[model samples]
Target chain A: MTIAVPTWRNQVSPVLDEAENFTVVEFKGGKQVKSVLINLAGKSQMERIRQLEAIGADVILCGAVSNYYYNLVSARNIKLIPWLRGNVSTVLDAFLSNGLEHKRFIMPGCRRRRRMCRRFGQINKRKE
Target chain B: MAKKRQSTELSDKPRLTNEEVSAILNSIADGVFTVDKDWRITSFNKAAEKITGVPENEAVGEYCCDVFRASICETECALHSTMETGKPVINKAIYIVNSDGEKVPISISTALLKDKDGNIIGGVETFRDLSMVEQLRKELHGKFVFEDIVSKNERMNRIFEILPLIAESDSPVLIEGESGTGKELIATAIHNLSQRRDGTFLRVNCGALPDNLLESELFGYKAGAFTDARKDKPGRFELAGKGTILLDEIGDISPALQVKLLRVLQDGTFEPLGGIKTLKSEARIIASTNRRLSEMVNEGKFRQDLYYRINVVKLEVPPLRERREDIPLLVEHFIGKFNRLKGKDISGIAADVARILINYDYPGNIRELENIIEHAFVLLSGGVISKEYLPDDILHRKSEVTTGAFSNVDDFQKRMILDALRRNNWNRTATAKDLGMHKTTLYRKIRNLGIELPARDGR
Candidate 1:
């Protein structure tokens, strides 16, 4: 699966740079997955999402996402991993080791009821 | 038989046509809804459908509460009360939850719908969407007040009041103050509150650019004006048309450019570089200076004409020492601001620290005070700010009492004598007696010290 990361100024992709701690990694079938990375250097979030979707990214990793934007991206079948705060390499290592399995990524302003709904859907239906 | 037939026909006649009533109700942009005496929904129009998101088909046969779920009832509902009293209710703003569970603001009016017999049958309410008014009210509340400025001094307050008034007029304004006195803040407040508020507010730091670059930035540049001028670009003046442009650090501009600026101010026109067409200038100009421009004019460093043109209205901001009373207040304000920014919960400064702050003459003024507060907050421990947190300059300044800078031995002696006398309640005879000197000489010394003697013996 191809993963996309949005950065404002700093380069945080750990496969390209080893020293940075807050990096993003992709995996498929329990093996390290080589992915296509898209740089949204100076564009706004909406514009970045449009660019990423145009390049056919399956998952997006970013520091934070707004509620409206989360809904828009989720509606487009793109998986969103948010609140990934750390150095590039450490975050990438954690993702590669399956340590990010229990991390909860909630959009800003998403109601508690909606989170509960998502939790129930994941538990009973195995809906990813 | 004919009379019976005519009576039956009249009895079977239809009421007002549905098409006519629907057209009338639908033509009104305001939401129109009617409820019977028992508060059952009798009619709902297309506008009501659009406003409440409940179609007429769903609303016609249900009670108002069942259809709209409004918390409004006979005693609480303004519409119901007006209908019961046969009076009309004027515009009233009310918040209601729409079908999508979004709170919508609405201005509504209600009246009693009566029959030909003058008896109240039902109530009709007409309401308009109030989202625009709500948005404008929010915008108005979001306006930058004088408190938005960080300074607590009287000089800044005076500027805040004068800036809005100056913004109303079309004349040029010159703001003179020390560096970092928030000259830019004053200019922005003027533009944001002015009649040209909707227009752009452009700034060009006169000291930041060279003469050629500054000229090109102020006056537009046409294609082929210079090596980098591959395309035409409108300068700040034209872009700030019908708006305001702040010429920051205007004192540093060269004399030649000063002449050009003076011509633009006088004629309200300037030509772009490498272009023959002279564009009509309509921007209001506000210039700031930290240097003494009038002195520069005297020394031939600045043009007299340009100085006078920009100085149409001069505002001089006093330095912070002149407003010492505002220092403690400013310190607290800055502490609060930085505490939130730095995520430190420093409650306040200690009394001794406050005293030192009050006594010190801040040469850098408000900006200096802000820096000191920020520094103190950074080093503060256990949420208490003490003198130890202060910079070395503040703590190391020599005390006046310990400096010993008096003119002569006599001056020191007089000061000591007067201090002793005042401490002893000005009893000169007793003071002389204490110091083993004659009362007359002590009196002479007191007189020489300029000490006022109280009237005695009614002489």
Candidate 2:
């Protein structure tokens, strides 16, 4: 059962009309597609993470991940798919075609330090 | 016992020191009057004469109620209550019908004057006029609600009317305008007015965050989904259930997010970070962009599909220069608002300052106008705001060089008049005929333009 994590960065998630944030799209095979939309009432990043966990989200696909939150979510056994860029549709197509291997997840604190996580198979090429 | 009775007899008749009593009563500035237990006025000082416009000869020994035009002393008087309760009354406001028949506001403070044995003998009451304080309160209340969101232009009025209507709808709305046009304010107004008025109105700057971080922020991740995934998280879509969300600077968002957004539009469903269960939400979307999305699409920078989805309803806010008529109204609103906030008594804007404001093009729109007004209020010396308070940028713009040729409508009209006069060799009749106007009207226009005709020999 391959589940899809809908995100604002990549097109794996369903884009809600009037939805301010990204939501998770569950697809069982190609036919069963159920969407769960989430909006963080507050702008705080910590509150957003907590709300997602409460809703039983398994994976997060995003364009960028802060190290502090990345570590916090990773410690809970949730898969973090980061560094997914492009339009919503293009990202969704990429997710549907290549699955998890094609997606890029950045390590927490990599933004400031420019360090790449070993799990994603990329080394820190950019100087901090 | 006979020696003690002789000492008491000497002390019973204490010496009346007139100078000391007069000095004590005259030293204080508030109206002071002493009334005995029988309510008969015993003493009235200089301050009392100024407050009541009555002299001591007319007030002394008079019944306090009869002198003050009251039916009785203890019925409704604050001073009587203080005397009876033996407690000092402090700053009680009362309306008095003075000798001129005009109602004057006064604050009265009273205390029961006691003798050496601590027995209540009489009451002393002090009252001061509260007309100034009442004026200040009126000014403060005027400053609160009348000042913000200034603009009297028809366009702004129209916007005020439409704002409530837009808020009533649940459809996705796209606000397009130049920077500093209060697009975010319009979005907020819509959220505040809509059925989800009480719900959270989340705003995300699409241009500020990159793709991956933005995605995760929008859609939560599962715990241990990756090495750093600490716990499962819910995204903004789920968090905004039955609430309104604002996608600010939507033009800067990536195309990938656009596709995911399209799916949500197709079906209100999305999956969590690593969870198998699909979540459903009914979050309303509102998007805003200062950049021209259509132009961006043409340049291949933005997605057409996403543009269509967000552009379900579009509202364009015009710049300040385009609505010059609203400048006066906005100026008044800002002045009133800032006056109360800054505790200034600024009455209004100077005519010359208003003229300068109307002429200048506000690149920052309403927000910029508000800032300028606030600055002006702070710098205003007296009740009047002058042009000197305005910033240098507001005074000067890059001067446009005109080659003495016709550029605008006024210039074109001037050029046409000059050409006709020259062609007709300064002949008024011929010039008017050539320009297709009445000779008298042409003469008036020539006078208005201050056109000089060359000297000609009398024929």
Candidate 3:
């Protein structure tokens, strides 16, 4: 599975729409296979969506995505795990371990801590 | 005796009672709340309860993040920052989803709560709902819009004013215009403003299809109505149930089709090609033709009865040449549109390019101008659309070389005045001052040049 994360200073970007670069990580059998950084700053929203689509990203993990960006990203059939804030590898490890539902990774200010668990359940349901 | 004396001394030092503090918080207009170091709500004021739609009693024990649902909660929590840094954040714009799950715009401020010993204990955040302000801004933005059409032209503005009134009634409307004058757009606008807006809006070009095909396309055909007519097919009129159907190029239909259409307009009833039962049409008919139906009627090319039947309410869309003042507005609109579509940030047309556009009498009207801008967008690399990016015909074609004089002094003068007026944003005084002319002279020149001023009727 190819997972895309908009990154800033080696962490999930504070705001998904303003992200300049994305880390596209390909995982197979719960292990990282390939990781590449893709620059998407100064491009339109549609262009950013296209870049993610080009990489065949199955999921996107990011922070503070607006409704407009959410609709655009979701329309491309990619599962967007928004409101995530943490170091890139740490978050990725948590995701791989299915610990993404824990409160430690909840983006600050989000009211529902368990929403991440629901989002993970949805992603798994889609996979099945 | 020592404990009593100590309590008396502490009381004498000055402290607000809980009631006084609550009164102060409730009196202020802004929503205020305090949270402990662990992010649990410690105090929820009356205003906070009102803004968040959660009562103070209910909100006090809950987590502050859960109550606010603020966008900054996940990224830039001012309260969290204040708690960590022991500093205050003032009046930052943020958004929150209320208990009802509606996004609400708000501005917030945060400060750390400290004891007399200067040790941080908790954080307090104050917020104000911006619903009224945001609503005003939305209404202001809507002031420039009419249906899907945007224009500053007086005639178009007049049409915009009366469109809702026209849409309220169920009557046949005849729209006359040169090709590319947006006849179909007006028809659609009418349909959208009417009560039938939620229903389907269909269009059929009478000129594009032959008489037999047009007949079946408008009235439908039954199964085995003719060879290859195996299944019953519904036409544009049938599909437009309780909605609107735009019959474009109505003048070009054959006489046989015209009579049938006249019956539909007059009686709102028609039968399928081979069906025995007659069906009532709940659709409103809007007929449009670039050719003058009045002239066609006089020339015996079009039926007089049909022309009068469809001409119950007529709208003549002014060609772009007649409404040259809208060119810049239309250009800006198209530039913004194409920027989103093509992912390019072309600012606008260059001065020389604007001059050329204003000078060229657009024979093909607004549609042609849109195509020109689209062409420039394709060729332009960045910044703006200069003369170099324009089509070769627009750049090199001269008046005397192909059609007329390349540099007509009068046309240039008119275009310059129009450009100046637009640059000054139709401020007559500023435009006159910038032009180094008297206001009277400017007004006279505007009159002579036929530049339509912005509508004063609250557009």
Candidate 4:
């Protein structure tokens, strides 16, 4: 399963629409296998989603996102886990260990501002 | 002893406390926010919370971009600019994505917050929502706006009125205009308003490429068709797929290619390069040219049949000088565009700059004015653009056109009248229309200017 996260300096990028770097990690047999950083620079709102779609990203972990981008990503059928924060390693470990339900992982200041996004780490496991 | 007493007297004055400052901030209508050097929000006022839909308590201590969600937050944040340049950005129009995920158009101004010791502690930004203003402007100027093309000129408005009818029809459209008079915009508008808007719209510049290259570009080649043909490729005709294709500068194509194009227009079918099977095209055709196709046909340089085929519907765009009224509107439009593009807070042109821009005949039309504004943006970091920021040619042209070139007003008028007469082949009515004057007024001007007539008269 390939999971993508828009990343900054050790943390999730502030907003997905304007985020520059996306880390696509491929997990194999409940362990890590491959990780690649893709640049999402200078892409339009629709083109950004198309880029993720082209990369075969199954689940997208990101921070706050505009409705325009949220709708487009949803239309593309990519599992979007938005409003996430913390150090990349911590978030990844929590995601791997299913520890994201812990309150510390929810993006600060946005606890009361959740949209139609799903609860953290409730992503359905896809068949390999 | 007297100096010490004066210092004591100064210190005794009443001072506003932190609560007073917060109260003052909250009382204002515009959204105001402050961020520390670490890019974390230090304060978010009541208006800021209202505009962003994020509570002040929820916004503070968070990274500003996460709360502000400005379109330029990641690329060229105004607060970042203020912190670096030591210059405030005043009234820069931008949009912020609110908590509800809605993009709210807002104009922001940023300044560096400094302590009493003159050390920069943080940056402050104030913004006002422009959605209502934008909506009102749109409603008030709906007639002058057609798609992205903004013009208050009468001729352009006439074209805008007929564009709906043109879009409804499936016939080939021919748009004739000066190079920068927005022929491509008119074509795109028709395509967007047409039934094929969901399909892709592609354009090919016939004058940009050589004949052989253009032929292959329009009609793709099969594998082994030529030296570079390694695989069968789909050309614009096939890729357009019932959409629309704009053939810009169609007058530039060679007569050989014209026949192939004529066949496509006649029966909507053509064979690809070195391909035996005939392929059909359902793409609607919209052709545009800077040159007159009829004149080219008269000279046998362009095909008569092809000209008639593509000229089923025609649009003629006036030059900048002919549509002189659009200059100020276009200047504002271009300034707003460049503010977002170049990430500057340029408000508008200075009064003298606007005067010069309005009077100068843009030989290159709207595109020239756009380039001029872009050039000004490079020289102007913020605030209104002045005369010095304009290009040298435009500066010189303004003086030459207005004063220096002609000995007197009569000489300039004579020169202009003579040129207009020659342009219309001495036809009084067409010359009058071209000059935006009455026919008799032009005739009287011709008589008073002592302009001589040639033997082969247009009359």
Per-model CA lDDT versus the true structure: 0.63, 0.60, 0.73, 0.77
User: Model 2: per-residue lDDT, tens digit, B1-459?
Assistant: 999999799789777698888888878887788998876788888877655545677667755543443211223576678877888988877644333222345788888988878888899888776545654663443211111234435565556545556777878899988877767777877776688866766788888999877777776778976678897878888888888778888887778877777767657777666777877768889998889989998999988877787788888877776765455556655564565456677666654464456556677877788888888776764466667777777777413322222234454456556644643335576566555578899879878877777564000
TM-score of 4: 0.49
lDDT: worst 10-residue window of model 1 chain B: B398-407
> Over the stretch B1-459, how does candidate 1's per-residue lDDT look in tens digits?
999999789768876798889899999888888898887778888888776656687667555543443323212576767976777888877754344222356877889988767788898888886655664553344333233454434455556546656877889989888876667667877777688888878889999999999999999899998999999999999999898899999999998889889888999989899999989889999999899999999999989999999999988877666765455456755664675456677666664565566666666768888898888876763365777789888776614222223445466456446533532225565455444468798878877777665452101
Q: Which stretches of candidate 1 lie over 4 Å from their true place?
A: A1-128, B1-144, B150-161, B380-382, B397-459
Model 4 has an lDDT value of: 0.77
List, residue by residue over B1-459, the lDDT tens digit for candidate 3. 999999789869978889999999999889999988888898888888877766776577666765676767656789978887877899899877554323467999999888778778898999998766754553343211133364546687666656667788999999999999988888887887788888877889999998899999999999999999999998788999999899999999998888899899989989999999898899999999999999999999999999999999999999887776666667766675676566687767765676677666777888889999899889875577777778888666524222332365556557666655543335576556555568899889889878777662101
| Model 4: residues with Cα > 4 Å off, grouped in runs | A1-128, B1-145, B399-459
Give each prediction's DockQ, rounded to 2 decimals: 0.01, 0.01, 0.01, 0.06
Candidate 4 chain B lowest-lDDT run of ten:
B138-147
Q: Give the candidate order by descending TM-score.
A: 3, 4, 1, 2
Best by lDDT: 4
Q: Note the residue pairs that clash in candidate 3.
A: A108-B73, A108-B74, A109-B73, B399-B404, B400-B404
Candidate number that wins on DockQ, 3 or 4 = 4
Q: Tell me the tens digit of each residue's lDDT in model 4 across B145-240.
A: 233676646687667657877887999999999899989888888887788888877889999999999999999899999998999998899999
Candidate 1 matches the true fold with a TM-score of 0.45
